[model samples]
Target chain A: DTAVSQTPKYLVTQMGNDKSIKCEQNLGHDTMYWYKQDSKKFLKIMFSYNNKELIINETVPNRFSPKSPDKAHLNLHINSLELGDSAVYFCASSQDWGQQGTQYFGPGTRLLVL
Target chain B: QQQVKQSPQSLIVQKGGISIINCAYENTAFDYFPWYQQFPGKGPALLIAIRPDVSEKKEGRFTISFNKSAKQFSLHIMDSQPGDSATYFCAASGRTGANNLFFGTGTRLTVIP
Candidate 1:
């Protein structure tokens, strides 16, 4: 079974168009995260939730909002997407928020804004 | 500012040769260090990891060499095979509520047969 899964493997939209990406993890993990990988392949964390509570919010703009309905699901919604929003979004999950916990990543959703 | 710096944005190695990727960090608070391997069209996967206390950790042909004093660590692939070619990332994180990972730019390794 896939430990972490993401829907809409690819997305292409125009500027000002809003879109959402869904992520789910079946590893029975309590912590889930959203990450953005830019064109240069630099990966950075956007948001993190533990047990349906927001734990980490980076310097991302307000256009990007992450919602976790439960411990297994975390979704990302982008409002009025801009050209700079083009990148790959990855969903990850870990047993918990700890220094030693191993995070498992999903395949990733490739987003392109025109 | 990038907390972790990785060198040689890209590398090419012949089969049966050794592939090495180096990384440096500026945060002394970082206690967990990990190397992630990512293939094309896929997300990064944890390949191996090391802590400040350990000087080295070896798993199969992949080994991580860590130096806490120098605040530097490296990944060495022994007898690298074509299948091992991928983009490798070095990341550091400290114990926090989020435990956010600070990732390096990434080193793309190409193993040629």
Candidate 2:
């Protein structure tokens, strides 16, 4: 069984379009995260949710919002996407986001905004 | 500024050789360090990790060396096999409160058999 799973492995949308990416983890973890990997392969944290509550919100644009319906699911919604929004978004989950356990990652959602 | 700096952005090693990737972090608050391996069209998977309290940790063929005072760490893959080829990342996190990781750029290592 895949520990972490994401839907829409590839997405191509135009500017001003709004889209959402779904993520689910079966490890029963309390924390889930959203990371954006840019063209330079730099993975930057976007948002994190612990027990369905917002925990960490990085310096990301306000248009990008992360929502966690429950401990097992976290989804990212991008509004009015721009050209720079093209990148790979990864979903991850960990037991505590600490040293005790590792963060399991999903396949990834490649988004392209034209 | 890159909080965690990684070196030798790319590396090529012969099979049965050692492959090493280095990383340094600026934040002293970081207490946990982890390395991840990623293949094409895939998200990264945790390979190994270390805490500031320990100087070294070895798991299977992958190892992590951490220097607390120097704020440096490195990943070592012993007897690197061609199957081990992948992109590696070094990351750091704080000691308290939802320690979200700050990742390094990445290191692409290719093992030639």
Clashes of each: 0, 0
Once fitted onto the true fold, the runs of candidate 2 whose alpha carbons sit more than 4 angstroms away are A97-100
B-chain TM-score, every candidate? 0.98, 0.97
Error of 2 at B83 (Å): 0.7
lDDT of 2 by residue, A1-114 (tens): 999999899999999999999999999888898999999999998887786357655579999988877779999999999999999999999897543458889999999999
In angstroms, the error of model 2 at A113 is: 0.6
What lDDT score goes with residue B87 in model 2? Answer: 94
Per-residue lDDT of candidate 1, residues B1-113 (tens digit) = 79999988999999999999999999898999999999999999999999888899999999999999999999999999999999999999998667678899999999999
| Per-candidate DockQ vs. reference | 0.77, 0.69
lDDT of 2 by residue, B18-97 (tens): 99999999889888899999999999998989888789999988999888888999999999999999999999988666
lDDT of 2 at B3: 90
- Candidate 2: TM-score, chain B only: 0.97
Candidate 1 CAPRI grade: medium
